[model samples]
Target: MPSNKAELAVRIAAAQPGDSVRGLFFKTVFSLIQQHAGPAALESVRVDALATNYSDLRTYPVQDFLTLMYRAADVLEATVGPENAVFHACGETGVTRYATGPGMLIFGIISRGDPQKLFAGAQMGYSAAVSYGSREYLSTGPKSGTLRVRRDMLPPAYHEGILTGALKVLGLKGTARAHAHDIDRVDYDIEWG
Candidate 1:
């Protein structure tokens, strides 16, 4: 999995040189900040920790990306409200548009957000499709499934919003409930009928 991730990062770097692992996310994030917190506040954001150039397509330490994201979450929570605002903030701004071309076409053919197929894609190292630190398929029923997304390092609010937005994009009516087993992991019960 790590190899696959590294390969993808390499491809991304090659495709868009002078960009960070954050890639398109950098512009979108700043745009969101500007909208939610005003341009002045956006300017105050120290994005340097993530990378010297937000537009630079260079491989950066994953921890730096995480720190920048958590800080963005703080900004959104304070400016946009705490209830998954970061997710909604990004979702409403068309973050999933990043999944362009064949990648999304396949997902669209799968009837949008089918957990089973999505999981398969993630297992195949298609993190852009559906990502988690380390996920385990716990229980899958005819109409629902449970995904144990370990590495609760990132806030659930972040995932919850992204999950909801992704499902919605696929035209799937679903609800996700996140259970924090420990600070290190979370169990998400995603239900659809």
Candidate 2:
């Protein structure tokens, strides 16, 4: 975990070049901060860390989102526990919010209550969400698959939360283990009913 604000800033500055995330994520995280820590905390993160206001119609740099996520995790960690746990829950909520909202119709039609389709459809979802990285879901068996992501901007735990959240929202029992090959790469081994 980042030991202090400066460390966090350095981490954000280290984000990959030319990477950006959709504005919906900004709105989602702002809502998360407001829900967990209140308006003041949200405002602080927005102005101090993000250096901008939330806008659902524009894309923001990956570093800005990282700052928001890390700062939000720091604020909510006291109430939510460890940093990983906070990020995990945030990931879960992020995906849940998106999957149930703007992404609803498309994901619903693509997934059709099937995990395989959901996994395959995730690539499209990823494309719609971020301007960097690539996600590929390869089936290993009838009930298992590997979700490989390259140049991922988020932490491994966050992606783990994403996989689990996706399964949960689909009402499937499952497990997802994240394999972080490097800061920019991760592979998820997933099994579901």
Candidate 3:
């Protein structure tokens, strides 16, 4: 997991030319930690954003990724604003914008007015969460789907925010309502205008 995460981090960083954009994610997370949780908490989290300052890709523990997600989400909620949703949009938009190779194919498919492709991309994108797998029902209705993920992993509203924001960025109107049926998976009923 550590090695795979390192490779992915490097791959995402390579979406842009410079190293500064490479670590912008961890850098933003660390800054939020320092501002809200203070230096001690920041130190406890223990991911040095400065490592991304160079043109090299750094490998961080997989736990760091998980921790950052929760902490960053917490910071977003505690800070009070719509800024946290921006995190999702920023990452997705970055990937959509600077994407090359196979990503170009993805963007192309998405450009031809297919909302199902968007959900497919979201399904695959969220799959990056360690070994998590999402089950998406894309053939249900017109530009509508059901995305199911672990209930305990992320707040349902976070997923809703990401869906709405990302779809808006992609020039579609998206709305999500979450339903938790059991202790395992939560279903996000997604519809777009």
Candidate 4:
């Protein structure tokens, strides 16, 4: 039999990237958890909301992604628990904005045991091929972007926060400094357990 963490890792790793925006988001979240939390921690944690932007492509329209995300949230609420679940959507504008093309997908899973805790969160974006500023439209514009997303899931913010907080709760500390890239942003702080 696989260890608890290993089992969790398998469950997460087994998730396939569906043919929609949210599929990638779930895959990214699962991958990140596998990378950072290891098998044991994963087994200990329970995922509350597995929100996705797209649920059905055939019957559901593309613009209705937000609605579908809400539906997914409902599913999570019903499957997991109602009190601790959250579902969010972002478009090409405002705080939830992304690049011009296909926009991005953001989803998060709360910790069942600790409502305030976050097990994992993820954001993914895809840009279609397009032309820009007198330049010839390249067939390959922006493909996709993936990363672990969390609101205060880490140090300087612990269990009371999100995924990083859950990591802290599990005793995963940051030894390196913070850094930002044009494509991504990462923050790190020391941890002790």
Candidate 5:
């Protein structure tokens, strides 16, 4: 829906209050910006979002996180073009880093390399990372499923990208198609081989 940073900023400013995200998310987004758009771009985003001192153990308002996300998207678009793909790539990097992190290593081992298992645990992961919203995973068959997310404020491409990244980390090739019902709700139909 929002094709540019200005529109995204307006939407984020009006988002419902009370939700907060783990500061680790800010770091991931900053890393992505620094890698693709350079440190200056990253610094610009941090200043714009007023997120210069984000810490992994703290929580920050979701609005601030959305501002960072929207700003990061703009920088990525400027540097990479093909806006949606860049946002998706940003989401992938976020998930890939988290999945490979020390905290999530046990979940991966417990999943026994099954993407479905990893997907089914998405709600737990999401809960740990944010203070609001919900994620539900539904299995359609042996290699297909749907992920329904509610009340999440992230861009749809980012959510779909998480699904793509999740499958990749589990060594499966998959596709995730986002069906957004609004900014607040989306369902991602996913299949893997």
Candidate 6:
């Protein structure tokens, strides 16, 4: 790995408590974008609103953000193969709450799965209520849904390296292209770097 990239990864790994993970992740991704895609590329990239449930209360410095991105990249690389890409924050933006148990934290990735397609699907979904009998219209809906299907195409190898760097920071093990499940969710494309 290049020195600058390695340093960034290491810094992210070294992040302590009270840091901003989301902010750092965004900056890191932007740095990678500037490095590979150039300043012009930044203009093309559009960050969606933080998911409704997402909160900024959680503090993650650069290191924490990098660690999370790295872990996510590891999962993607195992599924998609190495590629010249980077991970961006997707899904609900908020303090990720953990249950009082052992488990892995979940994150989402957004990419140009089918560059050939003209439109990318929305990342979230919801249901509306309809009246039954005596009650007026009331709806029960999901908070979110799968945004896109896994394209099964591998990204370039460098992309995987970025993810690997991030994972090393968190000291977490990642599986290649594992099928993570959510009710009524679509398959997300994953690859290993």
Top lDDT: which candidate number?
A: 2
Q: What is the TM-score of each candidate against the true structure?
A: 0.67, 0.88, 0.54, 0.22, 0.88, 0.26
Scanning candidate 2 in windows of ten residues, the lowest lDDT window is 1-10
User: Which residue segments of model 4 deviate by more than 4 Å?
Assistant: 1-23, 26-65, 83-193
Off by over 4 Å in 6: 1-21, 46-85, 88-163, 166-175, 183-193
What lDDT is obtained when candidate 2 is compared to the true structure? Answer: 0.79
Predicted candidate 3 versus true structure: per-residue lDDT over 1-193, tens digit per residue: 0112343344343232221223334554566567765786666555554333321133343334434555454444444334335345334433443233224444456545476776677555443322343556555687788876652333345456656655665677768787866433578888888
Better of 1 and 3 by lDDT: 1
Which regions of candidate 3 are displaced past 4 Å?
1-62, 81-105, 127-131, 150-152, 182-184
Q: What would the per-residue lDDT of candidate 2 be over residues 1-193, giving only the tens digit for each residue?
A: 4414664565566577778887778787778778888988777777754766656657788888887788888777766667788778778888888797666864688888788889987778887778888899999999999999997758777788888888888898888898888767789999987
RMSD of each: 8.6, 2.3, 9.5, 18.0, 2.4, 17.5
Q: Estimate candidate 4's alpha-carbon lDDT, on a 0 to 1 scale.
A: 0.26
Q: lDDT for each of the candidates? A: 0.53, 0.79, 0.50, 0.26, 0.78, 0.28
lDDT of 6 by residue, 2-119 (tens): 1234534544443444434334234444444445545555444423322112222333343434434443343334333332233422111111111001111112232122211101
Instruction: Name the runs in model 5 displaced over 4 angstroms.
Output: 1-3, 6-14, 102-106
Give lDDT for model 1.
Answer: 0.53
Cα lDDT tens digits for candidate 4, 5-112: 332333233333331233333333333334444554333332333333322112222212223323333333333333122221111011121111122122122333
52 in model 1: Cα distance from truth in Å? Answer: 3.1
- Higher-ranked by TM-score: 1 or 4: 1
Give residue 95's error in model 5 in angstroms: 0.8
Please say which candidate is ahead in TM-score: 4 or 6: 6
